[model samples]
Target: MSETTEEATLGLIADIPPGFIHAFVASLSVIVVSELGDKTFFIAAIMAMKHSRLTVFAGAISALGLMTVLSALFGYVATYIPKIYTTYIAALLFFIFGLKMICDGCTMSEDEGEEEFNEVQDTLKRTDEDADVESQTADPAEVQKRSKILNVVRRITFALFSRVFIQSFTMTFLAEWGDRSQLATVILAAAEDVVGVCLGGVLGHALCTGLAVLGGRIVAQKISVRTVTIIGGFVFLIFAMTTLIFE
Candidate 1:
C-alpha cells in the first residue's frame, strides 16, 4: 500500500506541467496590482454595502473566474501562431495597455470610479424597492397574519440570496467584460502557460474580489486614484519590457 501510494504521488507530481509556477506568479502579481481601483472592484464593494457578503462574494468571484477561463482559452488559441509572433504580440499589447492606462490616469477625473458606484447604488436601491413593491400582497394584514418567522426564514434562505446573487453576478460580469485585467489575462495566457495563467488569474480575482467585499472602499478612499493608476501603468510598462527581455 505504501509503495502504491508513493507511486501515485510521484505520478501526480510528474503530470504537472512545466512553466506553471512562473506563469502563475506573473499572472497573479500583475492582476492583483492592476485590479485595484478598477470599476468592477468598486462594483463589488458597492454591492456589498447593501447586499449579503456571501452572495456578492460568490457572484463576483464566479463571474471573474468565468471571464478568466474564457480569456485563457482565447489566448491558448492564439498560441497556434508562431511563438515568436506571439511573444511580440503580447509585448505590444502590454505596451499599448501601459500607454492607455498612463493617459487615462493623467486625465482621470477626481471621481474616476466613484460615479459608477453611486450609479450602481442608486439603481440597486430603486430596484430593491421595486422588487419589494412587486412582491407585496394586495392585503398587508394577510401578510402580517402569516407566520412571521417562516416568512423571515423564506426571505433569508431563498429570496435574498437569489436576488443579490443575480444582481451581483450580472453587474460584475457586464462591468468586466472588456476590462483591462481581462485583456491582460488574455495576453498573458497567449504567451505563457494557459492553465497557469487561468489558475493565477482566478486566484488573483478571488483575492481582489474578497478585498472589495470585505472593505476595500476604505483603502480606495485612503489612496489617490491618480496615484494608483499611474503606478499600475508603470507596472504594466515594466512587465512589457520584461516580457520582451525574457522572451
Candidate 2:
C-alpha cells in the first residue's frame, strides 16, 4: 500500500514542469482561440438580447468560473492516477461533446430563436410608439421619471433576477460540460502549473463570454447556429483524433 501511494505521488511530481508563466500563456491562448466560434458564444449573445446583460454576464461568468475550477481539480487528480485512465477519460469526453454538438446542430431551428428575438424587438417598438402618442397630454418630465422608476424596479427584482440567472447559468453550465476548451484546460493543468491554468482559463472564458454578451446580438444574426456547431464539432473531433494519435 505504501509503495503504491509513493508511486502515485512520484507520478504527480514527474509531470509538473517549472514554468508557471508558460502554463498561463498556453492555457489562455488555447481557450480563447478554442472558444471563438463556440456554441457558448452564440448562447451568451442571444440570451443577452432577451434578458438583462448584467445578469446574463453574471450567470455565465459564474458558470464558467465553477467549471474551470472543476476542470482544474479533475486535472490535479489525473496527475495522481494512471496515465491510461486519464487518456481514456479525456478521449471519451472529447467524443461525447463532439457527437452531442453535431446532433444538436442537426436538430436545432435557428429560425425559431431569430423569430422570437424579432417579436421581442417589435413589441418594444410598438409599446414605445404608443407611449409617445399617449404622452402628448402628459407632462414630459413625469413620464421620464416614471420610465426611470420602472427601469430601476425591473433591474432590482429578485424574482426576475433569479429566473434569468438560473436560465443563463444552466445553459452555460451544460454547454461547456465537456467542451473543447474545458477538456483542454483539464489536460493542461495535469501537465502544467495548476494555479496558472486555473487563472488563465477563468480569464479566457470571461473574455469570450463578455464579448458575446456585449456584442453578440449583432454577430449572432450574421452567423448561423448550424455553422458554429458544426465547426465546433469538427474541431473537437479533430482534437480527439490527434490526442489518440499522439498517445
Candidate 3:
C-alpha cells in the first residue's frame, strides 16, 4: 500500500503542468509591485467596505485571470515576430505612457484643486483619528444584499475570458513592432520544441496583478488616493526612463 501510494503521489506531481510553477512565480512578483498602490485595489477596497470580502476577492481574481489570458495570447504572437523589434516596441510604449504620466503630474486644474481642498478640510473635521474613514464608505450589509455571488462569478468568467483575448491580441499585434520578451519567447519556443510561451506570459502577468490587488488594499489604509496616484505616476515615469535608456 505504501509503495503504491508513493508512486501515486509522484504521478500527481508530475501531472501538474510545468508552466504552472513558472507562471505563479513570475506573475506574482510583477503584479504585486505594480498593484501595490493601483486603482484596482482602490476599487476592491470600495467593494469590500461596501459589500462582502468574498465579492471583492472574486472580482479581483476575475480581473487577474483576464489579464493572464491576455498576456498568454500576446506571448503566442511573440513566437512569430522577430525578437529585437518586439523589445524596442514594448519599451517605446512604456516610455510614452510614462512621459504622459510625468506631464500630467505637473498640472492641477482649478476645480480639481478646490475639490481637493474640500477633501482635506473634511479630513481635518474627523473627530475619530483611531477609526479610519474616507470619501466613500459603503455599508457591507447593504452592499452584500446587492452583490450576488452567482451573478458575479458568471460575469467574471465571461469578462475575464473576453478581455484576456482582446488585450492579448492587441499586445501581440503591437509586439510585431518590437518587444524583448516576445523575441525571447519566440527563440525559446523554437529551440525547446515547446509552445508554452503564452502560458508563461499569462502566468507572469497573473502573478504581478494579484500582488497589485493586495497592495491596493494595504496602501489604501495608510494614505490618501491622491498620494497613491502620485507614487504610481512616479513609478511609471521611472519605468519609462529605464525603457528609454536601455532600449
Candidate 4:
C-alpha cells in the first residue's frame, strides 16, 4: 500500500474522539470480560451449535448494530439531559438489571433441578454400563442435528432479534453511565472544533460491541449458563452501585 493510504487507514482506526474511545474502551472491556463467562455467551454458543456459523454471526452482528444505534441515540440525548439526571437513570437501570439477574438465578436453580431429573431418566434408560459410557459422550451427529433446528429458529425468530437488540442496548448503555469515557467525551467535545467526540463515541462503541459478542462466544466454551448470568447480573449491580456513589 502507498504511504498515504497507510496513513489514511491508521487515521480511520484512530479517528474517534478520545472521550468516546476512552469511555467505550473502559466500559466495553469490563463488560466483555464479565460476559466472558456469562449468559449471553451461552446463548451465542447454543445458537452456534444449532446453526451455521454464518447464521450465528449474522444474528449476533445484527443485534450488535441495532444496539449500537440505540446506544448512540441515547448517548446523544444524554448530552442534553442534565448530568445528574442521566446518571440517576443509568444507575436505576443497572440496578433493575441486577435484580432481573437475581431472579434469573432463581429460575436457573429450578432448571438445575430439571437437569438432575434428566440425569436420573438417563440412568434408567441405560441397559448396560457400556451403553451408559456411550451416552456419557455426546454424539457429534446429534449436536449437528440439533444445530439445524437452532439455525431455523435464528433465521425465523423476530423475537430473538428484538430480544438481542434490547439486551445489547440495555447492557451497553447501563455499563456506560457516568463512565470515564463518557466524561472524556464531554471534555473532548469542548476541546475539539469538529464532531470528534461524537465520531469517537460511535467508533469506540462499535469496537466494544464487537468484542462483547466475541467475548460471549469465548465464554460459552468454558462456563455454564447459570454461572454466566449470575456473574453478569452481579457486575451490573456493582456498576449500578458505583454510579449511585459517583453520580
Candidate 5:
C-alpha cells in the first residue's frame, strides 16, 4: 500500500512539465514589473480605504485570476494560429494601452477632478455611517429586527461582500483589457507552460494588490496616481518594444 501511494504521488508530481518552474518564474517576473504602479494598483488602494481590506483583496485577486484564465485560454487558442501573428497582436495592444495610459495621466479635465472629489466625499460619508451604526445601541428585540431588515436590504442591494466584489471585479476586469499584463500573459502562455504562466501571473497580481490594500491610505497619500500611471505606461511601452524586437 505504501509503495502504491508513493508511486501515485510521484506520478502526480511528474504530470507537471519539467519546464513549468522556468515558465512560472518568467511569468511572475514579467507580470510584477509590468503591473507595478498600474492604475489598478491605485484603484485597489482607494477601494481598500473605503471597504473591507479582505474583501478588496479577495475581489481584486479573483478578478486577476479570471483575467489570467481568459488570457491563458486566448493564448492557447493562439497556439492554433500562427505565432508571429499573435506576437504582433500582443505587441500592438501593449503599445496602445501604454499610449492611452500616458495620455490619461497627462490630462485630467475639471469635470473629472470634481467627480473624483465627490467620490472621495461619498466614501468618507459611508465610512462615518458604518461607524455610527456599529456604535448605536437598541433593545435586543429591536436590534434583532434591525439586523433582519438589514440582511434583507443587503440581499436586495447586494451590499457588503457582493457589492465590493462586483465593483472590484468590474473595475479590474475593464481596466485590464488590452493592458500589458494581460498581453504578457498571452505571450507567456504561447511561449511557456500555460498552467505555470497562469499560476505565476495570478500570484504576482495577488501580491501587488494585497500590498496596495494593506497600504491603503498611507500609499495613497505618499504616491501620486499620475506619477504611478506614467511609470506603468513607460513600462508597458518598453515591454511592447522588447516584444517587437525579440519576438
Candidate 6:
C-alpha cells in the first residue's frame, strides 16, 4: 500500500480491532451488493441520458460521498443511541419514497414528463442568464460588452456543467436520503473501522453510479423514461421490504 493508504489503515486499525483491510473489504462487498438495482443507480442513468456524463457523474459521486460521510458519522454516534430507531426511520423513508416514485412513474405520460423536464432545464438556463445579467455594471456600453462576453462563457459553463451538476446533486441527494445502502453503511460502520467503512462505501457507490451513467447513455435511446421510472420504483419497494426484513 502507499503511504496514504498505510496511514488510513493504521488510523482505522487504531480504533477497530479487525484492521483496515477487513473493514474495507467487508464494507465494499456489502455496499456493492446492496446498491445493485437500487433507485439511485437508475437515477444516475436517467440523468446521464439527459445531461453531460461527467457532470452527472461528478454530482452523483459527490452526493454519495456526502451520504457516506453522514452515514459514518451517524454510525459512530449510533453507539450512544438505540439503533432500532434509525432502522425504523430508514424503513419508513424507503417506503414513502418508493410509493412516490411509483406514483410519478404511473401518472406521468412520456410526453408530459419530457415537457416538464425541459421546462425545468429552460427555467434553470434563464435563471443563470438573469443572474449573469444582474451582475453587469451600470454603464450601458460596458454592460452590453460584458453581457456578450459573459453569455458565451455562461452558455458553455452552464449547459455543460452547472445545470447537470445541480440536477444530479439534487436528485441523487434526495434519492439517497434514508436509502438502504446508507443504512448498510451505518450498520457496517458500527461493526467495523469508521474510516475504512466510509472509504469502501464511497468506492462502492462510485462504481455503481459510474456504471449507471455509462449504461444510461446507451439504454436511454432504447427505453422510455416512464418505464425506467416504474422499474426503479419497484426496485425501491423491494429495497424497503428487504431492509425491513434484514436490517
Ranking by TM-score: 1, 5, 2, 6, 4, 3
Among these predictions, the greatest TM-score belongs to 1
Pull out the clashing pairs in model 1: none
Pairs that clash in candidate 6:
none
TM-scores for all candidates: the values are 0.76, 0.54, 0.42, 0.42, 0.58, 0.52
Using TM-score as the yardstick, the better of models 4 and 5 is 5
Inter-residue clash pairs, candidate 2? none
lDDT of each: 0.82, 0.73, 0.44, 0.49, 0.73, 0.70
Tens-place lDDT per residue, model 2, 62-96, is 99899999999989987787766766666666677
Candidate 6: Cα lDDT at 162: 89
Predicted model with the maximum lDDT? 1
> Per-residue CA lDDT of candidate 6, range 1-247, in tens?
8999999998986876544665576567656655544567667776777678888999999999999999888878865656566556645655675677678779967654345445544655686688788776467888789889899988887876687797788878887898767876776565446798888888988887887789844443344556655665665566556555544
Better of 5 and 6 by TM-score: 5
Q: Over the stretch 1-247, how does candidate 4's per-residue lDDT look in tens digits? A: 9999999999997985554453444355334433443333334444444345445545544444444444445455555656667667766766776677667765785244234334433443453466568667878899689778787786666555654443334433453455433443333233221243354445544443344345534433334546655765776677666655544
Q: On lDDT, who's better, 2 or 4?
A: 2
Tens-digit lDDT track for model 5 on 33-152? Answer: 666556677667778877888888888888889999999888887778787886677677767867877887778442442344346546646866886776675567887888887978
Model 6, CA-based lDDT? 0.70
Model 4: residues >4 Å from true position, as ranges?
1-22, 25-55, 110-222, 244-246
Q: In each prediction, how many residue pairs overlap at the backbone (N, C-alpha, C within less than 3 A)?
A: 0, 0, 17, 7, 0, 0
Model 1 agreement with the true structure over 24-107: per-residue lDDT tens digits: 876887788778777788888988887788889998998999999999998999989988898898989888988888898899
Q: Write the residue-wise lDDT of candidate 3 on 93-151 in tens digits.
A: 54554455445545634234234434433443352342345213768766576567557
Model 5 spans with C-alpha error above 4 angstroms: 1-18, 82-161, 220-247
- Compute the lDDT of residue 120 as modeled in candidate 3: 34
